[model samples]
Every structure is written in C-alpha cells, then in structure tokens.
Target: MTHHPTQSPQFFLTAPSPCPYIEGQFERKVFTHLVGDKAPEMNDLLTQGGFRRSQNIAYRPACETCRACVSVRIIADEFKPSKNMKRILRRNADLIGAMHDAEPTTEQYSLFRTYLDARHRKGGMSDMTVLDYAMMVEDTHVDTKIIEYRRRGPDSFITGKGQGELIAVALTDKMADGLSMVYSYYNPELEDRSLGTFLILDHIARARAAGHPHVYLGYWVEGSRKMAYKVRFGPQEHLGPKGWDRFDTEAV
Candidate 1:
C-alpha cells in the first residue's frame, strides 16, 4: 500500500517504566525521531502539537487509560509575580545568565551528572554517561538554546556571561510565541538558590522583552509538589480540549 510521507511519520513505543513524578504508577511513551534537514521544522510543529523531546526523540505521555499530564503555558504579559515569586527572584539577584547555542560541553555534562546524582539519582536519567548528556543538549533539531547561570563576574554586564560555576542550565526552545523550557537543572548543593523558580521568573521577563504572548511551562499536576511551582506564575493558561483556560488560584 502506498502512503504519504508526512502523514506516515515514523513512530515508536518506549518500554514501560516507573513514573518518577507519581507513586504507584507506570508510564509509557510513543515517540518519533527528530532528524535530517526538516528536523527543526518538524520539531516546532510537533511541540506546538504537545510533544516533549528527549535527545533525538519527540515524545509525550502515552500511558494507556490516563490523560493526567496536561500541557500549560504562561501568558507572560498578563502574569504577575506572587509574593513568594518576588522573594525568590530577589534571593537570586547575584546570578547572571548567558544565552548560547545549544551546544554541549564537558563542564555542562559535569553539572548535569551532578544534578542527576543529587536530585534524581533513582530516576531514569541517573545512569546517563557524558556522551548521553551531550546528545541531550546537542541533539536538538529545533530553535533550541541553552541558558547558563553563574555568579556575576566583574565583566558580566558587557559579556553577558557569568563566571564562578555553572549553577544552573536551561534547555529552552525559542518558539514563535514565546520560550518553552524543555528541561532545566541546577547545582543541587545550593538549595537556597531556588534556581528552579529563578529560571521561570527569568523566562517570563524574557518573553515580555521578546514581545511574545506566552511562555510555555509544560504540565502542572495538581497533587505534585514538584509541579506546584508552575502554578505560582499567576494568570496562566492550562490547555484543555475546548481551548486555553484562564485560571487564577486566588479566584478559585
């Protein structure tokens, strides 16, 4: 039987694995490769359609009989920082960020390994090698960029590059509407830095500066502490079957 190339996009299924975010649950995913000349274009379209990337694969939750992982994005222009978010940003004032091409390096892999070991040792990526980590950063086929955070140096304003140590790294997708944080990690040792929160805060400002309407923050599972932070970025929208639904925790 003949088939259309685009319509018959190659798809693959992942082996069942334990869910990291939720207890007593298993997870599986159906993925397709992002490669070749059209990879960037394909990645953009697939991401807009709700797929997340892992190295060369574009995937999303494909668990049988479950639809709990709903995608979400922040309407950056409308979003206002909560009291806690303001404090978090103030606490991280010393950090300076440098944006660069999505290219991987030894220092980045070192930090990535350290983060996984300290924060996600038992999770799926704990066993990843340096090469594996490189692929994660460098395999992107989209308009991907890396934001490196470090302590502000003497020449930071001019260089826009921070020094000291790579405390945090964000793998972000530069979308037409706004930035999509694909993945992020920080030096697990500095618990007080609140790098995770700072990263989101920075992205909101970034989206506003770029004249982008939204900054996609991905899913926010209600009962998960790990995901609860996503909700703090007020005046956000949660994607639903009908459309993007505006939600205000204070109003609820």
Candidate 2:
C-alpha cells in the first residue's frame, strides 16, 4: 500500500459486533492501519477527526443506527477541578505518577489482570494473556507512554519518579494537540482514592504543562452507565455533526 503523509488513508469497516456499552445494539468500526513513516502524522490527523488508536490500527464508531458514541476531549487549559475532584487529588497526594517509555513488564501485567478480573470480568479484554497485554502497550507505531502511579518515597522529589508499589497505570499517546488517554487501570480495591479520576486529572496537568490544549478521553456514550463518569470532566469538547462543540451541562 502506498503511504501518504498528506493524503487521506484507505479505511475499512469492521463486521457488526455486540455493543459493549449499550444493550441491544451493535457496533461497527471504520478503521485504517497506522504504519509506515507517516504513521505518526496520520495518527494525529485521525485523532483530531475523532479516531482512536489501538495497537497498529486507528478506528472510530461506524454504527448504522446509533450515534451515541461521541468523541470527547477535555479542554485542558481551561479546565477547573470540582470540589469533589479536589478531594480526590488531595486523597492521592501521597502518590506520584512517573512517565516512562512504552514498555511492558510483569508487574504491569499483574495489575492489569487483577484490574480486569475485578472490574471488567465480562469485557472483551478480560481474557487477554500477558503477551496480549504486552502488545497492547508496545505495539503502537505512534508515540506512546506508560505512566506509573506509585506511592512517593523519600527520594521521589529528586528522582521525579515514583517509588514503591504501583497503584495505577495509564497508557497514553502524546498527540499534537494534547495527551490522549488510551487506557487506564488502577487497584480496584482502592475505591476511595478514585485513581481513575486522578489519572485524568494528571493528564490534564501534563497537557497544560506541555502547552497542549486538550486531553482526549476516547468516546463517551450517552445513557451508558459505564461512561457516565466522563461527564464529570467539565467544559469538554464533543465531536458533533458541526465539528467540535463545547458540552457543558453546568451552563444550562
């Protein structure tokens, strides 16, 4: 296949599959391979067009009848934490997140398995083995990083990296506009700390520090209880029929 750095990619559609988020619905995806020298540039363009990268592929919802899966990106520079979010940050104050190259390890896989078994037992990735986990983290062609959240040790300030046991992990893509949180998992037992929310918060801070404008949070489905938490990140932009639009219910 001819690689086109400045041209549109050839997209293929996936066969219908049961919708993981919405019941009684099916999901189809329109995807293209992210490969060759132009992969990074292509990935960036597609991401701005609401495509999500997975391994060597980039895909988006192409359902026939449903449009509930809306692409959501937080406006990092303009975001302000809510009172509850402030509490979550305070609760996890003892922990630090260290960004590392996209490499897999046994420890991360162990935590991944534990997280899946506890929280996503019936989800598609629940049965993935260690090798599969490794591929998920390392197979991407575009820029990716694994952020490890660990309890702060005595030397954490100087090292600028965390120490001790890993409590959460975020698989993120460094996009041109902002950081894209591809996936994140945390110790399910530590419900009070709200590690998931903290990860998003950290991504926002990271994006702002890097002078990026947004943090992609993948798709948010309306009425899907699994995705309801995404709405909490206020002043997010949702890809709509008319392009990106501000979606703040609080303004209503």
Candidate 3:
C-alpha cells in the first residue's frame, strides 16, 4: 500500500477501547497514517497540531465529550529544575543515557517486556510480543531516536555509551518544533530513583543543548493522578482552545 497526500490531512476516529492510562473510561483516537514520501512532512504538521507519533501513526485523543487530555511542551531554554527535580538528578547520577538511532533489538524488547509486566501488566501493550516492540521502534517514518539508560560501566563515561543491563529507554521523535517523547519506560523495580521524572528533566536539558526551544511531553490528563506529575515540570505551555499558552498552577 502507498500513501496519498490529500489537500488536507484526513483524520479518522478509532472505535472505543478501554482506557490505558485511566480507569472506568473508554478511549478513542483520531489518527492518520504517516507513510510514503510525504510521511515526514505529514508527521510534522500532525504533531504541531497536538498529535503524538506512534510507529507509523500520528494520533490524538478523540473521546466523546471529554477534553481531559491537553498537549504539553516545555520551553527548554527558559526551564529551571525545581528542588525536587534537582534531587532526582543527583540521585541517579550513576545512571547514564546513550542516544542511538532508532533500531529494534532483542535487548530493548526484553526491557519492554519487564516494564510492562511490572508496571503496566493491565495495560493494552502488556500482551505485545517482541514483534510488536520491534514495530514500535522501527516503524517510525520520521526522525526518531532511542535513548537507553543503563548502569555506568568501565568505558562508558569516556565513550558516552553505557554498557550494562538496560534500566530505561525512551522512544523520541525529532520534529521541527521540538523533541517529542513518543513513549518511555523504566525498570519498575527501581522506585526510589524516580527514573520517570529524571528522564523528563534530562529531555529538557537535551532539547536545550540541541538548540530546540521545546520538549514535547505528550498530554497531561487533569483527573489522572498517575499523570499529574507531568505538570510538575514548571514553565510549561499547554495547548488550549486559543493556542499554546503558558500556565503556572500551584506545584504539587
């Protein structure tokens, strides 16, 4: 099959499915395929309009009557790490991350398996086989990078590549506006490190160093406490009915 460019990007809504992040509510997505020669350009447009790229699909929530999911991106150059976030950094200083080209591997799939079983056993991707994980990384048509975090090894610090068991991984997209984290997971056993928070902080630093102004953090669901931590990254701009606007709510 091939992709054809329409005058405008066509959006198709998905059938209802059980919500992965929130309980009791169903979820739907309005998505378009990112394929063929125009996939890259199409993806850029979709993402700027608040969609998240997953594999070859660009998707956004389309739940009936629900507006809980709001797009969020950090102004990297203007961001300052909070006291708590600073602590998370020093806490995980032993851990190091190496960014690699988007390539699928057995090792990545193994970590993905462990993460889903330990943290998201009840979620939709819990049953994904290695093939699915492969597609998750390799099927991307846009510029993508896979950043893997592991324990520091003998030659790692100098080489800038870690050599040890995979502790965490992030599937991120490089867009014209900023780097969008498509998905991220960690070793669920390491609760004290707050690996999730550290990853977000690191991404902000990365975007800043790369000269990108924003670091897209996907959506921030209001009522979902599990996702509430995302808002802690202060000086964020949330996409509203008007457009991307700055919001500063009291920190948790």
Q: Per-prediction TM-score, please?
A: 0.89, 0.96, 0.92
Q: List the residue pairs that clash in candidate 3.
A: none
Ranking by TM-score: 2, 3, 1
* By lDDT: ranked, best first: 2, 3, 1
lDDT of 1 by residue, 147-189 (tens): 9999999998899888997899999988888888988999988
The lowest-lDDT stretch of 10 consecutive residues in candidate 3 is 1-10
Looking at candidate 2, the ten consecutive residues that score lowest on lDDT are: 1-10
Q: How many residue pairs clash per model?
A: 0, 0, 0
> Model 1 off-target regions past 4 Å?
1-8
Every model's Cα RMSD, please? 3.1, 2.0, 1.9
Model 3 lDDT per residue over 75-180, tens place: 8899998898899999998888899899988888888899899988887799999888888899977899999998888998688987778899999988887789
Best by lDDT: 2
lDDT of 2 by residue, 1-252 (tens): 655343556789999999998889999999998877778888888999999999989999999999999999999999999999999999999999999899999999999999999999998998999999999999888899999999998999999888888899999999889999999999999999999899999999999999999999999988888888888897899999999999984742
TM-score of 2: 0.96
